[model samples]
Target: DIDPELKQTYDVMNRLRETIKNRDWPNYNQAFHPLQGCSEEMLAALQTLAAHHDEIGNTFTHHYTNGPLEGSNNKIKVIKRTGFGYRNFFRFRLRVLFAFRVHTKRALITK
Candidate 1:
């Protein structure tokens, strides 16, 4: 289990769904909603967060800030490194395609 403070932080974040519901903020950073991806669910969650902000009177809300894309990019770099000595363009293309397929499929299933 996570620590109480960590859980509290998470709870606070969940509460921010309401905070973002009512405002016309241009950016999620102002409300600290890091998980506000460009998805419908994220937009809805932001709307909820805005509404909650007004209810609770808390000005500063927070969320999961960073994306895993950078990590995935790093992994791709590693894969490229592993294929560094490939002489044929076709082999390189195959390696990259296979890596992308494996990574994206795993990410989708995990999500």
Candidate 2:
């Protein structure tokens, strides 16, 4: 059986996820309602959530996300790590461009 405190955490998180998915801003604010005599960790999480309220709401409100750019950055980091760092700036730039190039179609093999 899950602990009561952990269940509360999950329930709060699920509510937020559903709110964002549904773009229900009103309920999003409701999720941050004050709780008394809660665990220290939950209190800390509540503070963080309250701080980033606007940023989180803006995700669904604007329909803009940096997911694609973040993916590209991860790919570039992998290229650098696999090559153990490149000595030339031009070479690194070209490698990133070639990896992300959408003009050419190539089937990648997955293991």
The candidate that achieves the highest TM-score relative to the unseen native structure: 2
* Cα error of candidate 1 at position 46, Å: 28
Candidate 1 Cα outliers beyond 4 Å, as residue runs: 1-66, 102-111
Worst 10 residues of 2 by lDDT: 102-111
Candidate 1 per-residue lDDT, tens place, 1-111, comes to 446555545554555455457533443344454442334555665577557755434343444334688877787688778876678766665676676775564434421
lDDT of 1 at 12: 47
- What lDDT does model 1 reach? 0.55
Q: Number of clashes in every candidate structure?
A: 20, 0
lDDT of 2 by residue, 10-105 (tens): 677787789877999898899767464446787787799889887977875798888999988899899999989898876776677678773433
Instruction: Give each model a TM-score.
Output: 0.29, 0.64
- For model 1 the local lDDT of residue 99 reads 69
